[model samples]
Target: MRQGRRTGTTALLVGPAAAFFLLLLVLPLAVVVIYSFGERGAAGGYSPAFTFDNYLSLATRGQAFLNTLLLAPLGTLLCALVAFPLAYFLAVKTSPRWRTMLLVLIIVPFWASQLLRIYAWLLILGNRGIPSLLDLLGMDGVRLINTRFAVLLGMVYGYLPLMVFPIYVSLEKLDKRLLEASADLGAGAWGTFRQVTLPMSIAGVATGSLLVFILLMGEFIIPALLGGGKVFFIGNALVDLFLQSRNWPFGAAIAVSMVAIMLATIALYMRFMLGRSGLRQQALV
Candidate 1:
């Protein structure tokens, strides 16, 4: 009887949360799916008319899709490139005393809002900031703000901490003896890193890359602020559709498509990671 009561209480506690999620998340997603197939009303909201025109309209935002697809991956790669070495140094080389300090420093910027940090970048990269310094060096006025480079730089800066912590944890928990064993077997430093260190840290790299890439796909602010409304992305398209154009049906279609693409990317990343895991096990054997 007591066990029955306990189970009943647990179910009561979980029921509200499950229902809340179903109502708040699943129900809205279902609406989106339904609306994606339905036609826009003459007055501009969802209508009873069923059609695939919304899906077909996806091609209209091809440039945004292409830009997001290209830049998100490139930005993720750049973040990884910059983050890995710092993570490696902090995790493998730094003393315990300094490791915490260094890691804390990496994350300290996060204490401030990301929007604020990006705004700060505006000051540094603006006409009066870096351009003035360049003028002093006899360099011509360089347009830094409102460019793809600025967007990429902001992405790398914003996401660096997210990348570093994961890789650092993975490296810190790594078996140093394995690395020493590889070196003892006549492998060079790079060989040992490639064979031992890099392989083990694959999980972290995959995780961090996925996290950054998914967020980047949905990102609009940095590009909007730094690219000066010129750099278009799927996220920007969604924002424009909802806010400026107020085309919810088409926006929902685009959003659904973005979700589909994200799922596909995650699925592929998981498969690749699983294959790598199998290879690592085989190599160990």
Candidate 2:
């Protein structure tokens, strides 16, 4: 039948992508789960024995877990705060030609390697950089490099583009007539924005925040490079466990725990956002 031929063709088109997904993503996750329940070999790899000791050992890295939980949300909040205004202006205020140019400028940094960007930040924020300028200004002993502040700055700069684009897309797709309607109903600028503009852009804000938060949760490079091995996060702990200590089982346990925590956090956050929106809708009506 023609239907049979069409189905065969569809499968043929999708077969390689499906195979790659299973082979690369699903299989590696399955291996990690299997290794998490196994014993660590004497020679520094997984051994064929069932045990929960690895999961229990996670408590030893509690400080790393605490540090990550603190820093990740802080970075996500700052990213959202800085990006929203920039995105709104670009989407709502700027001329089309200038908007295109500015958006491109925002994304241009992403084309280069993230590592190279962070390394550039190191020199700019180092003793020979910002501190040198401060010294000339009579503010001696000012430090920027290898501190928590440097880590925060690096994370915000690195993740700003990811945060901005989603919000810009949302604001761009917004209905402008609603603002006119709000104004016709005697609403002031702030009132119109609060009742119409902000509500409509909630989807974009939620999407951008979730995207930034999820990535920040797994981020290791910013803390490692900017924090200069002085700051400890679960990501750094995982790297040490797998590469330095050769503790595969414990590393798998940490990864699995991180996945579980992120899923739970995201679910709760979505519920809160949806509930708040529902309440706002009722109030508006």
Candidate 3:
């Protein structure tokens, strides 16, 4: 009777979440997968027919794939590079008062609309903005907006807080005794950080990187607003296919392909990070 009750309680707790996941996520994905195997209708939506032509035609959007593959990782890397030091400073260097205030400042941006923030960046990087400032310094013909650089800048700016908070949490929870031990062994500042601080905080770095990279994969708004259509990502391609061209089958195929790629990449990343962490633990032991 107790076991039965426990099982019932477990099901009660998990049933809602499982149903929500299936109803929203899995069902939609299943529909998309089905649509991907069908044909484009006479009008705009799907038609009941099975074919591989949609998948085969993915080559036409190779540039979109290339751009997304390159930019997403690059943007994630840039976010990690910029966020690490800031996170470290907040977790280790700052006093409690300043840390709280600075953390609030970091998080305040997120409360605002992402579109509005990107639009602000659009203006800042426009011809009359930074380029004009550079022209004042004799760097004429300096274009900031509508470029890959602007897209990357926007991505880094938009995603930095996501990267920082994860790393900060990791570093904050790190054992201070390890640092003291490293110092007691006559390790210098750099040595202590390298041996103790960095390795200990690797979890945060991995978490932050994963968060930033995954989001960057499906990013459209940043590139759209900042790149001004000069740079196209897979997300943009999907938008065009489904909305503009009304090629539902092809769009579904692209979406499915993107999901596959992201899944594979994430699997590889998790495996690598886990292996590295295991090796580090062995070395520490």
Candidate 4:
């Protein structure tokens, strides 16, 4: 009787959330799947007629796909490259007192709206900012804004905190004695890092990379603002489809395809990380 009561209580606690998830997430997704098969109406909304044209039309946004595919990974990679070192330093090298302050500093910009922060970058990278300084040094009209470099820079800056926090957590929780043991076995700093540190931090790296990659895939505001409407992504395409063109069915199709691609990429990444982890375990043993 006591066990039955306990089980009932547990179910009661979880029941609302489960119901909420089913209603919000699962039901909506089922609707999208159903809609993806349906036809676009003459006025542009879902219709009952099933067709594959929507999916086939995915090929039409090839450039947007190509751009998103290229940039998202590249942006994630760049963020990881920059964030790893900062995280490593904060986790392993920095004194605890300074580390807290520095970590706070890293996240300070996030207290402001992201739009505001990106706008700040616009000022910094604009012709009046770095380019003007360059002009003083005899270089003229160094155009930094509205370029791919600007987009990349904005992406790296905006996402650095997200990347750093995960890595910091992983590295902070790391077993320091392992590094000592490696040194005891005559492993140099770089060798120890390659063998002990990097391998151990794979979870954090994977987490940060996946987080950034998925977000970057859906990113549009950064490209629009930083790239000055020149650089386009699938995110931009989707925005146009829904907001500008009001093509609800086509927009739904694009969204579904984007979700599918993100899932596939994340699955591949997880598999690769797991394989690497297995190899690392073997090497350590």
lDDT of each: 0.86, 0.88, 0.90, 0.86
TM-score of 1: 0.92
lDDT of 1 by residue, 1-285 (tens): 999999999999999999999999999998988888877667667776678898997999988888888899999999999999999999889999998899899989999998989998988999988988998999977989988899899999999999988888788889889988999999999999898999898777877887888899999888887777777789899888878777778988999999999899878877777565763342221
Q: Which candidate tops TM-score?
A: 1
Model 3 residue 64 lDDT score: 88
Comparison by TM-score, 2 against 3, better one = 3
RMSD to true structure for each model, in Å: 3.2, 3.7, 3.2, 3.5
Rank candidates, TM-score, best first. 1, 3, 2, 4
My TM-score estimates for the predictions, one after another, are 0.92, 0.90, 0.91, 0.89
lDDT of 4 by residue, 22-117 (tens): 999999888887887887777777778688888988888887888789888999999999999999999999999899999999999889999988
The lDDT leader among the candidates is 3
Off by over 4 Å in 1: 1-6, 276-285
- Give the higher-TM-score candidate: 3 or 4: 3
lDDT of model number 1: 0.86
**Deviating ranges (above 4 Å) for candidate 2:** 275-285
In candidate 2, which residue pairs clash?
none
Per-residue lDDT value at 273 in model 4: 75
Report clash pairs, candidate 4. Answer: none
Tens-place lDDT per residue, model 3, 12-37, is 99999999999999999999999999
Model 2 residue 107 distance off true place after TM-score fit, in angstroms: 0.9
